[model samples]
Target: MQTINLLLAGFQSAFELAAFITVVVGLLVGVIAGALPGISFVNAMAMALPFTYAMGATQAMLFLGGIYVGGVFGGSISAIMINVPGTPASLPSTWDGYAMTRKGQVKRALTIAVTASATGGLVSALMLTFLSAPFASFAMRFSQPEFFAATVLGLVSVIAIAKDKPIITLISLLIGMAIGTVGVDPLYGQARFSFGIPEVESGIRFVVVMIGLFAIGEVVDLVASNRDLRPKKTDGKPERVRLRDILAVKGAILRGTGIGCMIGVIPGAGATPGAVIAYGVEKQINPRGAEFGTGVEAGLAAPEAAKNATTGAAMVPLLTLGIPGSAATAIMLAAMMLQGVNPGPLLFIMDPSMVYTIFAAMIIANVLMIGAGFGVAQMFSTLMRTPPAILAAFIVVLSLIGAYGVRNNIFDVYVCLVFGVLGWAMKRVGFPSAPLVLGVILGPLAERYFLTAVANSRQDYSVFFTRPISATILFIAFVFVLWSLWPTLKSRIGRQPA
Candidate 1:
C-alpha cells in the first residue's frame, strides 16, 4: 500500500523541465563515457560532478545517478565488439561477449547487454523504493559490535569470491589497505605513509588509481596483443537480437536478476560481484554449462543481467539504511550529501517528495538508457570495422583526455603511463588483472569501515558478537570465506597420488 502511494505520488509530481533535461543529458553522457575504455562510472560521475554545482539538488542527483546506471552497460559495448571490457563490471561479459564478437554477433551481445541492464536496474530500483524504508528502520538498531561485524563480513565476502584461491585476493586487499594508509588518518591528523612526498600525504586519489589501473592498464594489454583482425566464424555482419533470442534465454535473465538483487541488497557486495557470481552460477546450473566458455547465449545473458540488476539492488542499502553497497553507491551518497540531502530514516519522513522524484527519474532514466545505449552501440558498431590504426589512436586519445580531465593535472597522465607499463609487465608475468583492480577499489572502504568500527568499539571485543544482526552478517561472511577455501584446504591436507 505504501509503495503504491509512493509510486502514484511520484508520478503525479511535476519534474522541473530543467531537472528532467539534466537526466536526459546524464543518460547521454553516461552512455558515451561508459562506452569508452578505462572511463568507468566513477570517473564519469566525478568528471561531471563539478558541473552540477549550479543545478538544483534533485536535478544533479538524477543526472549523476543516470550516468552511474548507464555507464556499467556501456563497458559491454567494447567488451563485446573489441574484446575489451570498458568497465570492471563488464569483465565476466568479456568471455562470451568477445567470443560472440569473434562470431560477428557483437550487436547481439550489445542488445542483450543493454536489455539485461535495464531489466536488472528496474528490478533493483523497484526493490529499493518498496523495501528500503523497512530496512532503514531495522538498520537503526545497529550498535558498535554489529557494525564492526558487518564490516568484517563485507571484506571477507569479497575475498571469498576468489574461486581459485582466497589468499591471493586477501593479499591484494591488504596491499590496497596499505596504500590507503598513505593519506591522512581519519581519527588523527598525522600523516601515515607520506614517504617524504607531500602529494602522498593525501594518499592516491581513487579516481587516479582507477584510471591508471583500468584505462592505462588496458592500453598496455591492447598494444601488447597487437592483433588487428578478429577471427570470423558467423556471418560477417553483426547479428541483431530478435525477440526470440531473449525468449530462448529467459531463464538466464530471471536467475541473474535474482542473484544480482540478492547480492546487491547486501551492504558491500556490488554489481561486479553479482555479475561474476551470477555468471559462475548460471554456467554451473545449466545443463549445457560446460559449453559456456565455448560461447553461448546463456553465458552472455547471465553477467549482463546481474550487472544491471545490481545497480538497483545497490541502492537498497544506500537509500534505506544510509549505507552504500558498492563504490558507485558510496559516491552517490557523497553526491547526495553534497546536495544537502541526508539519506536516512529522516529522509523518508522529511522529503517523501524527493524520494518519489528519485524513483520516477530512475524508471525514466532506464527507458532513456535503452534508446541511448542502442544509438551509441550502433555508432560504435560501425566504427568497430575501422582500421586498427584508427581504433588504437581513438582509444589513446580518449584515454589521455579522460586522465587529464579529472583534475587537469599532468601528473595523472604520467601516472597513467607508469601504470600502463606496469599493466603490460603484469600481463607478461600472467597475473590476473581483475583482482588487482578490485583490491584497489574495495581496499579503502574495508579499511575505513573497519577502523571506524574498532575506534567506536573502544576495546570491546564482545561488541561484534553481542549484536544479533551484526553477528549474523559476520557469520555469513565467514561461511562464504570457509566455503571458498574448503576445496583448497582439503587438497592441501591430502595430495592425490600421481
Candidate 2:
C-alpha cells in the first residue's frame, strides 16, 4: 500500500510538463546516439552531464533514466538495418538481424527487435520499482569473494556462445585477457607491457576498442563488397508488424528478460554479457537452434529483449548501493554526485520522491521507446538509400571521431585504426571477435575482484568456495559450461560409434 502511494506520487512528478519533455528529449538523444555506430549511449550521457547541472535532482535522474532506457534499445536500429552494431550489446543482433535485412525483411526485423526490447525493458523497470529495496538488502551481504564468483560466472558464460568451437573461443578469450593486462595492474598499479608509451600506461579504453572492432571492420566490408544499403520495399508499401508477430516470440522475451534482470543486478555484469548469454541460451532451447544465424525470429528477439532489460535492472545497484553496474550508470552516478546527491539506502529514505520519480521515468521511457525506436530506425533506414561509398565513408569518419572522443586523445584514434585492421583480418578468417570483446570487458573485473577477495582473506584461495553465495554461483557456472559443451560431446561420441 505504501509502495502504491509512492508510485502514484511518482507518476504525478514524472507527468509534469517540464519533466515529461526532458524525458522525451533525452530519449530522442539516446536513440540517435545509439543508432549511430561508435557513438554509444554512454557517450551521449557523458555529453549530457553538463546539461544536468542546471536541473533539479529529480529532473536530472528522470532525464538520464530516459536515455538509459531508450539508448539500450536504439542500437538495434543499425544492427538490424546495416549489419553494424551501434553498441557491444547489439553484437548478437548482427547474427540474425542483418541476415533478415539481407532477405529484405528489415522492417519485420526492426519491429520484432523494438517490441521485444520494449516489453523486456518495461518489465525490468517494474522490477526495479518494486524489488529494489529487497535486492539492495541482499546485495549488501555480498563481499569481494561473491563479486569474484559472479564475475567468473559471467566469464564462463561465454562458453555457451561457442558450443561448436570451444577451443577457438577459449583462445580468443585468453588473447583478449592478455590485451586487458597491457596497462597498469589493477591491484598494485604497476604498469606492465606499456613499452614506455605514456598513453599505453593509462590503459586501452574498451569503447575505443569496441568502436574499431565493430564499426571500422564493418565499413571496410561494406566498401570492399559494394553491398547495397537500401531496404527493399515490400510491394511498394511499408511492411506492417502484426500482433501475432509479437506473440510468436513471447517466450523468448520472457526468458531474455529474466536472464537480463538477474545478470544486471550483479555488479560488473552489464548489458553486453546479458544479451550475448541470452542469445546463446535461446539458441540452445529454441526449436530452430541450427537456424539461429539464418534470420530466425526468436534469435532476433531474445538479445534485443535482454539488452534493453538491463537498463532498469542495472540501476538497482546504482541507486541502492551507489555502485554503477555499467558504464552508462557510472555517468548517472557522476550526475547525481554533481547534484550533491549521494545514492544509497539513506537516499531512498530521505528522498523517496526523487527515487520513485526516477523509477516512474524509467517506466515511461520504456513505454515511449516503441515510438522513438521506430522513428529513429525509419530515419536511419532512409539514410541507407545513399550511395555505398558515401555511407561507408561516413561510418569510418564517425568511428574515428568516436574513438578520439573517448578521452579526447589521438592515441585512442591510432589504437582504433590498428584494431580496425586486426578486426577485418580476424573476420576474414571467420574468427569470433565477440568472445575477445567479452574477455576485455570482464577480465579486468574478475582480476580486480579476485585479487581483492584473496587479499581480504589473507591470501586464502579457498575463500571463494567456502562462501555460500560464491560457491553456489560457481557451481552454477560449472553446470553452464557442461551444458554448453554437451551437444558437441554427444555428437563426437555418436560419430565414434563405440
Which segments of candidate 1 are over 4 A away from where they belong? 1-6, 12-22, 38-61, 83-88, 99-103, 141-182, 185-193, 206-210, 229-233, 236-252, 259-303, 313-354, 486-498
Cα lDDT for residue 302, candidate 2:
92
Error of 2 at 373 (Å): 0.6
lDDT of each residue in 263-285, candidate 2, tens digit only: 78776678987898789888878
**Model 1 lDDT per residue over 28-104, tens place:** 88878878876777787877878877776767778888887888778887777775567767877876877877776
Q: Which is the leading candidate under lDDT?
A: 2
Error of model 1, residue 223, in angstroms: 3.4
lDDT of each: 0.72, 0.86
Give the TM-score comparing model 1 with the true structure, all chains together.
Answer: 0.80
Cα-based RMSD of candidate 2: 1.9
User: Which pairs clash (backbone N, Cα, C closer than 3 Å) in model 1?
Assistant: 120-309, 145-463
Separately for all candidates shown, the number of backbone clashes (residues 3 or more apart, or on different chains) is: 2, 0
